[model samples]
Target: MADVVLQTINLTKEFTKRKGLSSPRHFFDKVTFTAVRDVDLTVERGEIFGLLGPNGAGKTTLTKMLCTLMLPSGGSATINGYDIVRQQNQVKRSIALISSEERSFYWRLTGRENLKFFAALYGLSGRAARSRIDEVLELIGMAAAADRRFQEYSTGMKQRMALARGLLADPEIFFMDEPTKGLDPVATRQLHDFIRDELVRQGKTVVLATHHLAEAEQVCDRIGIMSNGEMKACGCVSDLVGEASLIEYFHLLIEESRLEQ
Candidate 1:
């Protein structure tokens, strides 16, 4: 069996709905709404596992929980066999996050300067960090722009820089949320190729959360369809999309979700 990069058991999150000050107050006024309910899932090592859902479908929330950004209200999770809650540091050390809304860096600094700062934080400091910074800048094709100020870089260039920083830690797993969200067509395709290459060549696992069905279908080894705080179906690309187009499969799953509510 493949190693488990990430796993969740009966994972759940609840938000307490607070009543308005002007509204009638009662003991039952405050209610709990589960954002993720009793979710049990596993992601295998070296596999690109996609989580697909519409807006407000709990994809982001679930990712947050897996990355230890938010505490789970119930159940448990482990990253690379280390408990996410009990062994937060070990979990963090094993994974890297590449957010679509990449963090802004000092615009005055060079592209390579930003990556060096991140590399140092990952404890890859001094000569080694400097060398790795150069390596990643080249690996991501940012070497040509390495000495240029980040403010002068284009949107796609900045996105590539952010991704380079994510890889600086030499992480075993990557959590990428809508990685190609704002890129142009060419940039998006370049990024898609890079993601695939990482899995096929470098043997890293990924948790990819995106609304793009076709992209998910093309890249994922397995996919889980989530809606309304639950997983509707999960399997290989063809297994779930078999005998139907991806668009049709998505609609069918979504319609089933509505019927449940």
Candidate 2:
């Protein structure tokens, strides 16, 4: 087996109810919501692993926990051998998260400027930052619109630019949450090709969290299906689903689960 670049053992997250301003405590009355529940997963180096689920199935929450954007309420995870909590700095340095949310970027800055700024955060300066920024923009096919104000860019363009920013640090592990959310067919195919080709050539491990079953089957080496904050099934597309498409397998599994419930 290839080296495990990312792993999570019983990883979980819980969101407690907010407390109103009161003299006495509301901890007893607080309701806890489990966003992710005991998710165990592994990703090998240079592999494309797809995390597939319907919306609100805890896909994004699991990614956030692995990437260190949000702390896991319980259990543990490691990225490139660094603990997500104790070794946060090392974990952060080794991974990049490309979320679908466009609001994370500075709307006033041009696409190039945004990359440059984020590159600086990773300690790249002077020629190093400029070169890296340009390289990523070209890779994402955003070079022509690199100077356009982010706010003025189309939704697809903004998503592309966000992807460029995520690669600025050249991290070992890439976590993408619905990366092709706003892209057209051509752009989506292009992004998928780039991810499977260029990034794979570089031996980067990608954890793609998306609900697109066909897209996952096309690009991922292995797929893990999630539902109601739990992992339902996991394996290679060929072995797990056989001749049937992923959608068919997924529906079968969902129906089985519903019957059990």
Candidate 3:
């Protein structure tokens, strides 16, 4: 039996846009834009599931809903068998979020210092926190640079630090949103290897949202292609790309989706 770790049923998110206050109609009228619509997704344990989409495709919205950062306007989801809506705390405990946002960290703080602070937020302290921080630093191959100020670190090192922070809690699942954004090709490849070689080795399930089709093909075990708030296609890489390059197939699906819209 396959162990399912994440599941979503008709997951949807909508944002309301109102006109300016100068217009009388603003008070009475609103436009509803659906960011994610009826997205049914399933991710199995210990597998890297990629959410591949272009901008405005709702990949980030879907991830946010699953992470409990944004409440779904409709439908439901569960992480590690815990309801994302009803059991918010439990859902949070079961997963970690990693993004390529360097501003989330204090510039002056050393990498180790930053991890320690985040560890405290995770309810770990003293020897337990220290041990975990050390473990993650080594795991991300940043033990030597742990004491360097975050601002001094290269983009790749910063990304590794972000991964280290995510691993602090040892969550069963990781939700990464454009984690390799702004990284060079070499750095991106290195990050991909770390995710596959080290993170998967620990039996962790990863949900990666990225615009890089090549990265998705290289890293993800299975991928779901999203377009205009809907899942356009999904399956194993080899199965989906049979007889055609992934780039060609990806463009075909995206073009077909545009025509339907």
Global lDDT of each model? 0.85, 0.87, 0.91
Q: How would you encode candidate 3's per-residue C-alpha lDDT over 193-258 as one tens digit per residue?
A: 989998899999999999889899899999999888989888898887884577876787678667
- What is candidate 1's CA lDDT for residue 91? 86
Scored by lDDT, the top model is 3
Q: Which candidate comes out best when scored by TM-score? A: 3
Q: Please, what are the lDDT tens digits per residue for candidate 2 over residues 65-123?
A: 88778999999998899999999999999998988898999999988888888989999
TM-score for all predictions? 0.91, 0.90, 0.93
| Backbone atom clashes (below 3 Å) for every candidate | 0, 0, 0
Q: Candidates 1 and 2: which is better by lDDT?
A: 2
C-alpha RMSD in Å of predicted model 1 compared with the true structure: 2.3
lDDT of 1 by residue, 1-261 (tens): 767878899988888876656466663477778888888999988889999977666888899888889899999999999998899889889988887874557788988888888787798989999888888888899999999999898889988998898889889998988888889999998888998985458989988998789889988888988888887778888877785576776777677666765
